[model samples]
Target: MNVKLILSTFLFGGLIIFNVNALPASLIERDGDTSLGTWQIVGESGVNAMHAFLVSARKVVFVDKLEGNALKRPDGISAISAEYDLDKNEARPLSIYTNTFCSAGAWLGNGTLVEAGGDNGDANFRSGRQTVRVYDQSIGDWYELEGIMPSMRWYPTMLSLPSGNVLVVGGSKAATGINKEAINNPTYTYYPPSGTVMEDYPLQFLAETLPNNLYPMVHVMPNFEGKPIIFLHANQRSISFDLGSGKVVFEYPKLPGAFRNYPLTGTSVILPLSSIDNYNARFMICGGNKAYEITSEGEASCGILDLMAENAEWEMNDFGGTPRVMPDATFLVDGTILFVNGARTGFAGYRKGGGANALWVNENPVLFPVLYDSYAKTFKPLASSIVPRMYHSVSTLVPDGTVLVTGSNPQGGVSLNVKYPTEYRVEIFSPPYLFSNTPRPNIISLQTFEINKERIKVYYQQIVTLIVQVAGGEPSFKASLIHHGFITHSQNMGQRFVWLDVVNVWMDTTVTDQYIVTVLLPPNSNIIAPGPSFIYLMNYDAPAYSGVEVLLNEQPA
Candidate 1:
């Protein structure tokens, strides 16, 4: 049976809605082997994915730079955007006026995908610097707002704030090897420009980091707008900044070993926050170049910082002997970190080959995918893919518990003949949990709303009862809320997985094979940020077959 698109039907209310079986595509029947899980060339992405995010379970919106993609628009221009259908395993081109090269995005609380910034375009492709585009479901396309941003930004990072706005931060006026003082954009601005607190607030931290601070790893904390703290990691240092005042809340100890932001491109994700840990914030950064100019191998270490610890200090873990440069670290539904993609050598840059051009950093694609058990602090190597996903490659967890992996254009301009050419072939990585003997959990409804028919507004600290069905499993149920944020350059901008506090779980007296689970959404939007969140019901240790997408909010969120 085919996987379904629940988010499309329930939230966006789009035209296409697949029948959700609440079960993952069982690899036992389709793929000949299931030991290392399964990998299949599902389909071709019409555009090379410089940016991608799962808009729904059945569809992914792929954004590319204005390049020589084989897919063309209605007017015959090379299309830079496409909507990929996971159900059909095919992609259809969508309209995008500006180039989205090296751009970043975050999902709004209202379910809008707002993407911003890009490089200068040629005569045909319009420039995207200072441009902002939001996905419009009504038109089934993108609505571009050209030059509306306060200033020009090339590779800015965006994060959804608790207040339902997107914060755009730190890019450069123009693309460079490492950001220079003259070209660095050391400030952050917000979209919706109407009720923004600060516009283009100059951040000295961005300047202090200099040369290597492009696309800083900025995450919204549970600081909640009253104090409002955002963790910013760039170059070798990390800082807690007050978004309200542009002042540093706390400057952290400098991370040793390698630079983890742009060019070097180490990936970091705010680790899954659990109630057991008091929802204390923790960040895990993995795989970056030891030096800006090294092509030998990346730093084989991963760093963890506990924000709420008594005396917060850096804890580094040695990545399973093998080093990586641009690996993507994503949280699985089963509460494990899946580190996939990226090359074992080189930085994140475009080049015909390696070492010749200092910025040329693409070689040796790391075929193996590793899962980091945060609880055990050990890495388990999973199946390796045949495709080489480097440079602009991206991966995100879907509703059916599969990792949708696609895109890699080391040299750029979309050529298929070269060694590591622009890769459009999509691959789905099914972790071992899917094929296990454990029973998969299912979420039936949220209050009055059914699984996939209408939008459900879940508020902060509200005890929402989930009607669930599972036969013969441990009564201990857990709820995992996730957002597959805009993924590009090893940064899943705004990607978050917050463990909902399950208050109680009791077998349903009225219905057979059913149970009533009560979970309190995070106290405020700060914990998970206010936006579209996927709620997964976990049965004991096994993963959920699929998730129910709901708009998670606080006040106006």
Candidate 2:
């Protein structure tokens, strides 16, 4: 017998809301989990935004933002000893240095912090020299080194080489951050004109090209052979550069979409706890505003890029349902990427308005955790939090596998006509499955189809596979073919199975007994849709929800 078609439905007030809208898409909680606790209020500095680096000894070294050019700037390096209890969430500040502008820096194995920019108290630009400042944490002092690139700089990026040397790349010196022709998408009107492109000025073209105002994000791939490589997004171009010899190793590769929407920042770290195989160490970039009006919404979206390969080629897949900018991201132990504080599209005037009204105003801001499945090439938005923020600091709590997230808009500040208090608030993100006793997954979407219709086929895009997984019990599922355009009652009975896979066959799972299962495609129907089949998972008393997801396999199906 064919399986009786079941469509997941929701209830409102006193009526049943049949979910024809929520099909084929679902989110389930994994048994694994982790968290980052807000333990200590290490001495605070002026409100600032920056990324932190984890040392071999687990020590975290970062530069404190000092008052510079009237804007919160990095004056010197600070060390945070790792003695803080990961469990108790207790922390203490080690030391902080004075006036220094380090657009970027990294820690060498020998205990010295190699910083780009200059030693004099100024932005990477005023110093007019891209030299390395070596700071010894043991003595709380810094020494300057000349003989590197000579000229003023800004937006400098640096990385520690395996040989104890540091690789610094990309920064411009013109009054505007980028070259004249390198204007950001005209939509980001708030960008300071001079800060936009800093290529040529009244003086000699400082160094070489002007500051692209772009991040030359550096990462040492597990297979990197002593060479320093960085993935850079120049405007919308994805290019890879070798820092050792200061040259563009690879020109550019096309992305699924433009890179302007979500620009790359900070460094890439390998996710240690996910079941991900092919992209064992996935590189992530998040929260940059997209070029406006170029697309349907006149807004952009958030996306991630896979940086595992050696070639300059890359792929961008959207995740954040809306556009976000200047947000910080960290990898969780379970392989999930924690996208902390960022601005949602509605809050546009906050940073891009080019006026006093450009501060973020998110009353009751929602923190939406984003999870990326590399194997699946899809993104899911997890539960929300109460942190409304943009340009905040986020780091991984490696020992306990939690993320240490802190700093965002404080109280009593207004942006775009919205007011927020400068916040010293910090919190932890623990997956619900591990922390909550009643792990229940929410139903997100559902869809139904005919078995034999000229157009109702699943193989339209070479997709002939149906995959499903039951969270707690066996999944008793079913499907039926339609005669011409008419529907039929069909049911398939079998022993309980946690998962199900069938080739060119109308099938279902024992939802009440299974955890998960996927549909397998037949080689013959590569370009044709599979016969319509009504799918159902046995309803459970214990909230067993399901939804559909489009898995865009990297390779052609």
Best by TM-score: 1
Q: How close to the true structure is residue 238 of candidate 2, measured as C-alpha lDDT? A: 53
Q: What C-alpha lDDT values do all the predictions have?
A: 0.80, 0.34
lDDT of 1 by residue, 160-274 (tens): 9877889899999987778899999998898876554335888899889987888899898765445667999999999898877768888888897888888888899888776
- Give me candidate 1's TM-score against the actual structure: 0.91
Give candidate 1 misplaced runs (Cα > 4 Å).
1-35, 195-198, 353-360, 473-475, 555-557
Candidate 1, poorest ten consecutive residues by summed lDDT: 8-17
User: Residue 45 of candidate 1: its Cα lDDT?
Assistant: 94
RMSD of 1: 6.6
* Residue pair clashes in candidate 1: none
Q: What's the number of clashes in each of the models?
A: 0, 82
| Predicted structure 2, TM vs. truth | 0.50
TM-score of every candidate: 0.91, 0.50
